[model samples]
Target: MSDPELATRLGAMIRDVPGYPQPGVVFKDITPLLADHDGFTAVVQALADAGRDDAGRPVVDKVVGMEARGFILAAPVALALGAGFVPVRKAGKLPRETHAVGYALEYGEATLEIHQDAIAPGERVLVVDDVLATGGTLAATRQLVAACGGTVVAAAVLMELAFLPGREAAGDLPLTALLVVDGA
Candidate 1:
């Protein structure tokens, strides 16, 4: 379940930038929401909830965040959950040896990498990202976690483009999205 009040407040903060980075695509810009201290705090709290069990105890051992925007949201989520934070970056971004996985994007293909030692064997993980689009990023992140011998218990995104096939692509992964946008 989602909080209607939070959804209403945060949704208002998201600016619809039409034709951003390309034509016919409306980007859901969240810089305004990120700038609001109260809104940001609320979002982090809500996302952190995914890593907790029904008893309200943190159930994950590590929180894995994808490259770029995911880094911003996942770091604080890890802190709130009292779990370790792991960054799944683009290829060659990390100095240490890493495990990498490639996936197809809407426009092209991309690869994601994670430090081989980031997640210990048998560790439980929670994946966090700013948005769920086609679900390629989330799927790749899950593979990276598996490569590192960790299990992803759940995934949380700030927003979901409901019009896309992201939910189907995600398969059976437990997903929680704060907001769902129906169309462009």
Candidate 2:
């Protein structure tokens, strides 16, 4: 059950900017869609649906949003699913004791951190992000959740760059992407 019109609308709003932050990289900018009331609402609802079961019951105890863009989508999703929101931040951004994981990006290596007490033992987690590219961030986030004794049930993204090997990097973790772009 997918909405064609919504897909069309959302797809149109995503602008492709060539060579952003680095050469040979086309950034999928989602600002236009976020600025629109209806589009934003629809996208949030769509992403939140990933945290539910087939019978429409919320199945996650926490919704984890990665650094920067992920925070924008995951906060509302957490509210929609009636779950707690946890932030997987960049190194040193968090004040308290945290568990850290270093990951390789397309350009360089980076580390992410989460508070030691962010999630109670055995909490179910759903990771949300703006885009799925190399999948390094998602993998590192998964490790962070595991350190907190939480399990990542699935992941949701607004867009997926199919040219990259993100799906493989995710391994067996379920991933739902609203729009799939075949190329960079």
Candidate 3:
């Protein structure tokens, strides 16, 4: 389906919660969409399509998903694309050698780590996350991928908090999101 149409449908499935985890934070909850098989399928398909390889094959060697929400979507996209799934998680979560990168968030600084062997040299990777808020998490994920000698093919998300400067911080990377919120 076209981006706009797909976005409309996906947007309909998202629930908005005010003051979640903090005051003045309007959280865009995605549980409703995750529970709907068709809605989830459409979202995963769209993300997988966005991360397609150049030869039209599932070119990504690894699908790198961020902590928490990212894993939900990335694993399915990895399976659909026939690629291996990797997770960039918080510190002390993985029981293996890891490489970490720090980035700035709205409130403070945060760090993300990926297994050192997650990606080998020249491996193509696609990073997936549920929401792109401040770009800090995604940017750090990109750096972690590079540290593992992986080439980031693209970064895809279910939604983008466009009010934040995530796109600009993401630089020239191929960033694709199913839905974008202008002010949320």
Best candidate (score: lDDT): 2
| Residue-level error in angstroms, candidate 2, position 118 | 0.3
Name the regions of candidate 2 deviating beyond 4 angstroms: 1-3
- Model 2: lDDT of residue 73: 97
What are the clash counts of all predictions, listed in order? 0, 0, 0
lDDT (Cα, tens digit) per residue for candidate 3, span 93-162 = 9999999998987556888999899899999999999998889998899899999888998889999999
Model 1 score (lDDT): 0.92
> lDDT (0-100) at residue 115 of candidate 2?
99
TM-score of each: 0.96, 0.97, 0.95
The predictions' CA RMSDs to the true structure, in order, are: 1.3, 1.1, 1.3
Q: Which whole-number lDDT from 0 to 100 does residue 108 have in model 2? A: 73
Better of 2 and 3 by TM-score: 2
lDDT of 1 at 33: 92
Better of 1 and 3 by lDDT: 1
- Candidate 3 segments exceeding 4 Å error: 53-55
Clashing pairs in 1: none
